[model samples]
Structure formats: structure tokens, C-alpha cells
Target: MILLISPEQTDDIEIKTLHQLFEAGLEHFHFRKPNATLDEHRAYLEQIDPTYYPYIMTHNFPVELTQEYAIKGIHLEERKWREQGAALETYVKSFTDKGFAVSSSYHEPEDLAAQPVTFAYHLLSPVFAAISKSDMQGRGFDVRDIPKFIAGMGGINAQTTPEAVKLGFQGVGALGGVWNAKDPIQAFKEMQSAFAKAYNKKI
Candidate 1:
């Protein structure tokens, strides 16, 4: 899987680029805008072609937004899932019952392994030095033994995508690697091509 994460902030050019990426066959789009309000998020989705709604996974207001739009599913940020405590399974089931996917983020492999509620997939970060945040150091996590469908985040780009695959990541998630590129569309295609070459399967 090749997951593309949204930048924290939005811009007109980014929106246009997003449409182009969707057309270019972006499958998993994590719509994460931490500071955007619900209305703002809705507005952003409205700008995109509705046909790509099935490829989107919102990071905020999962319950509200998923009900209103035919988005792929919801994502539980680390804090949100941790805060669920004993209610995590029930929360996930609520969406699963609706035939929507529910994924979550984790910082540690052990924490992800011990997670009781089975998410559609799990996101583990800082596998390499982060491109979006310079201060965060890379952990170089190797999940080869983990049985879960874990996607490696942090410092992922065309160059490091094959490395992540070799490290046993079932997927790769990118933010800065694509958004920070001189050409986001070409950057995405490069990552896809690199991933396919490494995994021996098209994403």
C-alpha cells in the first residue's frame, strides 16, 4: 500500500495537485489537517472530485464526516486511540459495522503488537529521520516479525520506499517526501514505481 498524507495546512495549489494525484491513481489518502475545523474540512473535500471519496480517510471528526460523505474510513491519531482506553474496540466496531475502514497510528512496535482492537492497518512512525520535522530522529524500526499490516511513516520518499519495504513495512506513508518535492505528482509516481520494483507488485 502507498498512503499519501495531507499537509497540515492547505493551499489552492495543493488542492489542485491533490486532484491530479487522485487522477494519477493515488489509492490511500489520509486526510489529516490537524488545525482545520469540521466546516473547513468539509470545504476542502468539496473542492475535490467526489469520485475519489472512496480513497479518503479522515483524521478528524470521523463519526461526523464519514456519515456525511462516502469517505473510505477514519484514522485514529495516537492520542485519540490511546484515550479510547477500554472503549477502543467499541469505537472501532461502530465504523466497521458501517463497512468503513478504521486505521490508527502508533509510535512503538510493541504497543502496536499489543493492541487488542484490530485496525484495518496501523501506522508506525520515525522509521527514518523525519523530513517534515527536522528535530525528530529516526528509530530505524524493523517490523519484519510483526504480523500486522503496518505502514512505515517518517522520512519516506522514493529513495527510502524500497528500504521501508525491505524493513518489512507492508505500506509506506508520506507527507514531506511528496509535498516538499519540487513536483508532488512526479514525486508520488516515483515512490509508486520504487515500491513496485521493491515489492514486486504494483501498489
Candidate 2:
């Protein structure tokens, strides 16, 4: 799948860019705004086309909006997944019982392998160096043996996305590769082309 993550800073251009990307066949959108307030988050979603709501996934306040907006799923950050422990299991169950997909993140391949398979999917990051954060280096780990639920993330772009697919990632998630590009929509299409070229299928 081709998942586009929101940058920390959201602007009118980014919002318009995202609509264009979705219209062009972007499948998933991770709505992560760490700095935005709750009201701001609501406002941002309000501005987006309601038809695109089903493709949206939020990292924050997911429970409140999952049913409210009829969104696709919720993504629990690694911190919440770890700190909440069993309590989080109940939370996941609540959503899963209602047919909501649950996903999370893991910084290490080993951690993801060892953890119970509760999440529908989990992100394995820094797999090809971070595009948004230069200081964050790529692990270059091969996750072919891991479960299909683990998506390779970080530093994912047109060039690196195919590499991730070759590494056996069920999906690839991009942030800076799209939002940081000269033409974000074009970059997304290029990423899609790269994925198709490598995997022989559309994202």
C-alpha cells in the first residue's frame, strides 16, 4: 500500500496537496499532527473532503474520531502502545470488535517480531534513512522473514520505496518524500510508479 503521512506543520498548500494526492490514488493517509491542538485537529479534518475520511488514519485522538468520522483505523504511537500495556489491549479490543483496524510502530525489527500480533499492522521505521530528519540514519535491515503486517518506513521515496518492497515490506509509508518534494503529487505518483515497477502491481 502507499501511505502518505502528514508533516508536523500543516498548511493550506499541504491540505490542497493531500486532496490531490488522494485523488491520484494514494490509499492511506496518516494524520499525525503532534503540535496541533484538539480543536486544530478537528478543524483540519473538517476542511478535508468528507469522502476522503474513510482513507484517513490519525495517530492522536483516534478513538474519538474513528466512529465519529467513519475513518478506516487508528494508529497508536510506540510510546502509547508500550506505556498503556494491557490497558491498551482493552482499547484495541474495543475498536477491533467494532471492525476498526489497529496499527502501531516499532523502531526495531526484533521488537516487532517478539511482540504479540495484536496489531493489524505495525510500522518498522528508519529502514532507509529519514528524509525529514537528516540525523536519523537508515538501518538497512532486511525484514523479508517478518510478518506481512510490518511496513517499512522512514526515508521512503521513489527510489527507496522499491527497495523497501524488495525487502518484503507489505507496505511503505512516506512523509518527507511527499511533503518535502518539489511537487508532492508528482512525487507520490513517481513513488507509485516505482512500486509498480518493482512489484508488478499497483499500490
Candidate 3:
């Protein structure tokens, strides 16, 4: 899947554009507005068409709230998985008991290798030159050893998506590649197409 991550800040225009993207078949949207308050998050969810709620995944929220918003799941930051240690297994199981899909992030292959808690997917950043952050250089990461469910993030777009999928990533996350585009919805559509073309071949 092509996961579209939200910009840290949102405006009315961006919210409307996100609706358009959902209508255009954008699945797995990681709704990560870390700075927004819970009330603000509620307001944002209220604005989105409820029919698209199932396509969203919130970052940094209580799992119970996912039920309230009908969100598909929650993505914990990499630090949580690292610091929680063995406690993560029981913590995540609680979510699974309620039928929530869990995900997390990683900065390197070694971190993923060391992680014992399984997730629906894990986002590995800086897989390519970061589209949003200039300093997080891509370094042309070789991803052969990572699990298939780990997603490649950072600077991914239509051109680089196929290669990431080919390298064994089950998914990819795009921030600047879409939100920073002249047309975010169109950028998402291209990303969807690229992911389908690449993923279909592996089957």
C-alpha cells in the first residue's frame, strides 16, 4: 500500500484536498498531527467524510480513540517500541484483542532486526533522500534483510516507489512527495498507480 502521511500542520485547503484524495482511492492515510490537541483532532475527524474513516491511521493517540473515530489503526513512534521493551508485546496485544492493527517506525535496519514485537507494518525512514527533511540523506539504503512488512519512507514518489517495492518493502510512506506537490491529490493518484504496478508484479 502507498501510505500518505499528513503534513505536521493542516489548513482548510489541505483538509479539503485530503477529502479529494480519499475519494480518489487513497488508502492507508497516516493521520499524524503531533502538535494538534485532542479536541483539534476530533474537529479534524469530524470534517473528513465519515465513509473514509476506515482508511485512516492516527499517530500518537489512545487506541480507544481509534474506536471512537473508526480509524483503521494506530502507529506508535519508534521510540515507544524501543523503550517499552518487552512490555510492548502485552501492550500491543491489548490493541489486537480489540482488533486494532498496530504499526511503528524505525530509522535503521538494525533497529528493526532487534525489534521483537510484530506489527501490521513498520515505517523505516530515510530510505531515499528525504522529501521533507534535507538533512536526512537517503544514502541509497539497501533493504534486503528487512521484513516485507517494513515500509520505506523519506523522499518516495512515483519514480522511486517501484524500486522500494522491488527491494522487498510491502509499503511506502510519502510526505513531501505528496503534500509538497503542486497538486496533492494528483500526486497521490500517481503514487497509487506506481504502487499497484510494482506490487502486482510481486504477486
Q: Rate the local accuracy (lDDT) of all candidates.
A: 0.94, 0.86, 0.84
Expressed as tens digits, the lDDT of each residue in 110-155 for candidate 1 is 9999998999999999999999999988899999999999999999
Best by TM-score: 1
Each candidate structure's count of clashing pairs: 0, 1, 0
| Tens-digit per-residue lDDT, 146-178, candidate 3 | 654778898899889998888778888999999
Clashes of 2: 1
Candidate 2 least-lDDT 10 residues: 194-203
Candidates ranked by TM-score = 1, 2, 3
TM-score of every candidate relative to the true structure: 0.97, 0.95, 0.93
Alpha-carbon deviation at 139 in model 1, angstroms: 0.6
Kindly give the stretch of ten consecutive residues in candidate 1 with the minimal lDDT sum: 194-203
**Residue pairs with clashing backbones, model 2:** 129-138
Index of the highest-lDDT prediction: 1
Q: How displaced is residue 31 in candidate 3, in Å? A: 0.9
Report the Cα lDDT for residue 73, model 2. 87
| Candidate 1 backbone collisions, by pair | none
Error of 3 at 60 (Å): 1.7
- By the TM-score metric, which is better: model 1 or model 2? 1
